[model samples]
Each structure stands twice: as C-alpha cells, then as structure tokens.
Target: MTDIDHELEVKAVAALSDGPFKCGTVAIVGRPNVGKSTLLNHILGMKLAITSRKAQTTRHRLLGIHTTDDTQYLFVDTPGFQQKHLNALNKGLNKTVTQVLTEVDVVLFVIEPMKLGDADRKVLQLLSDKTPTILVVNKLDLMGDKGNILPLIQDFDLEFPFSEIVPVSAKKSLNLDELLKSIRTYLPEQEAIYSEDELTDKNERFLAAELVREKIFRLLGDEIPYSVAVEVEKFEVVGKLRRIFCAIIVDKDSQKPMLIGKNGEKLKQISTEARQDMEKLFGGKVYLETWVKVKGGWADDARALKSLGY
Candidate 1:
C-alpha cells in the first residue's frame, strides 16, 4: 500500500476506537406494584432486587448496573412512593424516591397503562421539569387493545413534558430495547463508573437479607409481611459454600406464632425457598438458619430502623 493510504487507514481506526462513551445514573421511580423491580431485573437479565405482589416490598435504593458496548447504564431502583399510611418507615421510603430523582441524569417514570390515579400523580409531582424524564408505560400486556395506549400517552404528555414516551411490558419483556434506545439518547458522554461484569452495588449479605424478605412477602399474609423485617446476622463463606444465619424480626409477640406456625412449617418454607434463591444467585451451596424474634415498634422507631439498616 502507498504511505498516504496507510496513514489514512490508521486515522480511521483511531477515530472508531475513541468514540464517545455514555455513562450516567438513571432512576426508575413509580408507585408500588407498578413493576419497577421487574423492569430492572429484566433490563439487567438478573434478579438484583426483590419483588412481590405486595406493596412496599422494595424498601431500599438499589443500584443495578448495565453495560453495553459503548454505554454503562447505572439504574437505581428506588422504593415506591407512598402516599397514605405515612409512618416513619414509609416516610423514609418516600424520601429515598425524591432523593433519587434529584441525583439521576434520566428519570423513567413508570406507570400502569390507562390507569393514572392520585398515587401516580403524587409521584409525578416529585419529578423535575428540567430533567430528561421518560414516560415509561409498563404493563401493556394488561391492555386488551394496543391502540388504546395512544390516548394514555397523550394524557401523560399533558402531565409532564417528557423527553420520550416508550410503552413496554416489563413482565413480558416487550419493547425494552426501544426503551433502552430512548434512554441512551439522554445519557451524558462519559466513561463507565463500574466494570462491565458488575451487576449491582449491593453486597452478598444485603442480597441474602432481601431474598429472605422476599419469601416472607410472597408466602405470608399481607399484614405479616408489612410488619416483618429480615436481617442476616452472620454470613460466612467456606470455599463455594455460604453459611448464613438470619433473624426474622416481628413487631409484636402475638405475630410470632403466625410466622413459626404449627410444627415450625411456615418458617421452614420461608427458609427453604430463600435458600434456593440464594443458591441460584450466588452459584454456591447455602446453609441457611432462621429464627423469629419479636422487636416491638422497630419499624416506627428511628433508632431501631437505623440499627436494622433501613
């Protein structure tokens, strides 16, 4: 090849290699049971956050990182914004939602299709007009006619001047690629904050605790799950094996029998299911031990909440 042609080829290669990379935090905010955690799990292709049918199942702000070829999407799944029953616990959760909104580069305001209620509107008011917010209409599978979404999209547009509106069914994994593409346009050009292999910022102990809590939310009665909290007191690793000890904290002594059940069957089921999930997530044998403890008013007490890692 001629010297001039060789020099041109080298410049072209350098330009392609040094293309701009986009990386920034994206907050997923919505009311309870609108499928925020499900979207995060589907987008990352792993269960980084716990989910259930019950409201207020997600309490913490979890950072789920997704890295593409040239972009690193750090998705923060915040707790559902609570309007009623504002106790100390729910107040803390609401604060988490608002705090996440202010910090993120893009906000995905997820809602159910054709059902924007007072609760959804309350959460919408928390969003900033300045931020590049996307109206993510989740649960499209629930809609009988797909054509109905256009009017719903128009209704949401009146509520906020969204940068983009993408309809998707997170549970069905529909139109997620389009949602990702829409979000990519708003992300700032920067280097990745976390490695590509890293899926979440939470440690194994925190994930272990969340898995146990998920079992409680799924298996137990509605009231019991709301009043319960799981804590991983001890987590020891021994060469592809995890030995975990967890304490299930209840608000009152009367609630203990409901959790332990006759012949300890209820607690046993919770432990078994939690162990199975931990094994799947950690890719190791998990020896889990659980016990019920009564900690009265722990949910409402700020000191107790702080101690419990709330």
Candidate 2:
C-alpha cells in the first residue's frame, strides 16, 4: 500500500480504541449566505457545497468529512434559514435547518459579523436546550474594523450562553484550524463515520448536478438561479471518459430563453465552464449535455422537490 493508504489503515486501527478520540457530526447552521457552506468546504479542503451571494442556495444537509490522525469530523452543511411563503420548496428549505437539530453532536451557529437580527435571536431561543451550540461569527474579512466584532459578542453573550463563540473568515480561511481543534474537543469516542478516502456523502450525480446549478448561480442574476434545479439524467464512466446528460428545470417557460440565449450561445458557455470543472473533478475527459425545461411552478410543488431528491 501507498504511504497515505498505510496511514489511513493505521488511523482506522487506532479509531477502534476503547477510549478517547472519535468521529461525530457537526452541523453548520445559520441564516442565508452566512458562509456556512464555504466554511465546511474550507475545513474539508474541497468545494463540496455550492456557494453564492444568493439565499437558500443549499437546500439539503451535505456531509463533508475531515479525518485526521486523531479525529474525524463529519461536517453537516445545512440549508440556510429563511422566510417561508406558501410555497412547498420554501417550506422544505426552512425545515432543512430545523431538522438538523436532531442529528448532531455540535451545532455551529454561523452569524454575520455586521449585525445580529431578530432571526438570530429566534435561533438562539430555539436552541435553548443547550445542545452544545457554538456561536460562529463569520465574515470577519469583510469588516473594516476587526475590533467591532468583539463588542457584538459581548452584547449577545448575555442573551445566549453559547458553548463557545468563534470568530472566523470562512472565505479567507481564517482561524479554521482553531475551529477544527475546538470541534474535535467536543466529539465523542466512536469509529470513523466513513472510509478515510471518502470526502463527502453526495454521489457523483449529485455533484454533477450541483456544478451546473452553481454555474447558473454565478452567471445568472435575480430570481433565475433560485428557481432553478439541475438534475443529471445520465452519467457514464468508461475508463478515462465521462459522459453526462443534465437538465435545468425552471419554474417558468419564459426563463428558458434567458438560459439558452441567442442561438444557444449562453447555454454553450455554461456547459463549457461546467464541463471543464467536471473534468477537473473526475480527472478525465467529459462529454456534457445540458437542456433547459420549464416545470411550471415546480419550485412550489413538494412532490417535485421530493422527486428531485430534496
């Protein structure tokens, strides 16, 4: 076996020990766009979540594993909490954050450094059971005055007695190592949750779909990306080549033209970029096909969301 593989075997053996050192789930919870997904990606040293300035980009609880010589952390990246309308998608999205409470050893409550609103207060009230919540103040890099964040911590410190308050810049990778060290301190003794080589619970099809959705989020503005869903209909891996067929589902028929653009130029660009990234991900040649379809208010339909594996 290779040196790295041998190390994994040793760690796997060490994990079988009776006492001390373990693996557990650390759920990242926060309001929309607080960099919860970004922070998880940073901790795992890979882009496992689709991140953007847009709200509700993460609709599911994604598990990213970080295994070390002594500990393994299964970081759960949850959907951002937001206002839910009558729409089923919104309701499902709202439930995603709330559902995370039941299945975690530690809850990393991410809040922006700028302000703590009523939503933050509500989260504090909901997590009143003292579930080992860590109040994480993210986006420190965006603040002009670093010292300004300290006061917010002091102010809210009385409102909610958090297990630990950590200030970090998820985008800039600031204080992430310290965060990991802190997380490891809380986990209980257990065997590794997954194989050491496994980085995420999401399959290749899911990642492939996410790549397209992320590209749309990056390129398209307004409500276009939010009302969008990418599904990989076909994925064939033949030796060094990968063939992928994906569909972009939109709520309105009018949105199709915007995604396709004039003479399919826009769609081509999106595919080219996504395919290049996919090739890098798989380390092989990729043949990608993209098609846009209108699902007629599919975003509001619970059945649609369920079918999409949400």
Candidate 3:
C-alpha cells in the first residue's frame, strides 16, 4: 500500500518475533457528515468506504482489513445514526449502527473538531459501557490554532469515560500513525482470522453496487441521493475483463429522468465514473451498463428495503 506509514511498518515488522500478533474488529462510528468513512479509508490505505460531501452518504457497515506483519485490524465503517427521517430506510440504517456497537472490540467515536452538537451526543449515548471506546477528534487540520487541541480534548473528556482521545485529520493523513498506534494498543493478542493479503469482507458485486451509489451521491444534487440505491444485475468475467450490468433504484419515477439527464449523458457519466472506480478497486478492467428504475416509496417499505439488502 502506497499510503502505509513508514514508522508503522517499522514497528510492526520489528515486533514480528518479540510481540504477540494482535487482531480485532473496530467500529468507526459518529453522526452524519463527521468523516468516519474518510478515516477508515485512510487507515486501510484504500477507499473501501465510499465518501461524499452529503450527509448520511454511508448507508451500510462494511469491513476494511489492514494487515501488518504483527497486527491485523478489521474495521467496521457503519452508517451514521440517522435521526431526521424516521422512515424504514433510516430505521434500517440506524439499526445497522446500533447492532455493530455490540459486536466490536473497540469503538472509534469520531467527531469533527470543535463541533460536537446534539447529533454527536446521541451517537455517543449508544456506545456500550462494556466496550472500550476512543474519542477520535477528527479534522484537526482545519483548526487554526493547533495548541487549543488539548483543551478541546479536556472538554470532551468530561463528557465520557473514553479509553483514549486522539486528534487527527483523515483528509490530510495527519496524526494517522498515532491513531493506528492507539488502535493497536486496544486490540487483543490473537491469530489473524482473515488472510494477510485480504482487504475487505465485501465481495466484488456488493462493492460494485456501492460504487454506483457513490457516484450518484457525488455527482447528483442533494435531494436525489437519498432517494437512490444501486443494484448489480449481472457480473460476468471472461478471461481478464468484467462485464457488469446494474440497475439504479429510485424512490419515484420523476427522479429517473433527472438521473438519466438529457440524451442519457448524466447516466453515462455516472456509469463511467463508477466503472473507473471499480477498475481501480478490483485491479481489473470493467465493462459497465447502467439503467435507472423507479421503485416507488422503497425507502418507507420494509419489504422492499429487505429485498435490496438493507
């Protein structure tokens, strides 16, 4: 991995014989738009979690594994605990957030620096008392006065009994080594559950769909993103190239034309961008096809949500 920290590589490599191999799952969670996915992607040195500027862009919990010579970290990037819309989709996403809380060895309670409000508090309340948690104060690079970080930490410390508090900037890769070291300290000594080379638990098909959804979130306006979901219809590989067909699911028929755009240009851009991302992630060529389909009120329908693997 190009983004691998040299210091971490040295420490991990040096510990191969003297140290016990460490491994465990970490839940990276926070309120909507708090940079949880960005942090996870940086930790893994790859973009396993799709990120967007929009709130609630991440709608699922995906595992990203980072293996070193002496430690293996399995990180779960969960959807932000949604609160505004109490629809089936939001409920399902919230369920996903709460469910993973009980399953991790440690929790990284991510928050934007100097901006812990009601949403952040609600998410923090869900952190189990039994699980060791680290208050990850992210976006440190954005702050003008770096010296004030300690006092900010002290302020947050009074709010919860955190095992540790780390300030980092996931965007600039600032203090990431410190964050990784903090994570290593909490992981238990055990054998690696996954192969050393494995990156994530999600299959290619699942990730392909997410890639499309990510493009929709990245390229489209605010209103259409929440109303969209992606489904990979067919994934066929012949020799070295992948031939993939996908369906873009929308909550209403009116959104379809907008998504497709005049002369199908918008749809083509989405497909091309998503396919390029898939190729990079998969390390192979991809032939992609996309079409938008109206699935009316799927966000509020439990049955439809379940079928779509919500």
Among all candidates shown, the one with the greatest lDDT: 1
In model 3, the Cα lDDT at residue 17 comes to 52
Whole-model alpha-carbon lDDT for candidate 1: 0.89
By summed lDDT, which 10 consecutive residues of candidate 3 come out lowest?
1-10
How many clashes in candidate 2? 0
* lDDT string, candidate 2, 1-310, tens digits: 5777656775766767545657899989877888899999888777778887777778777889888866789988988777644368877776777778877899899998867888777666656455788888888788888878778888877877788888899989999988887887788887665767789988888888888888887777674757889888899998888899999999888889989989999899889989988887777899999999889888777788888988
What TM-score do all the candidates reach, one by one?
0.93, 0.91, 0.93
Give me the runs in candidate 2 sitting further than 4 Å from their true place.
1-19, 84-86, 223-225
TM-score winner between 2 and 3, please give it. 3
Residues 168-224, candidate 3, lDDT per residue (tens digit)? Answer: 999999999888889899899876777667899889999999999888888985757
Backbone clashes under 3 angstroms, per model: 0, 0, 0
lDDT of 1 at 96: 90
TM-score of predicted structure 2: 0.91
Candidate 2 lDDT trough over 10 residues, lowest sum: 121-130
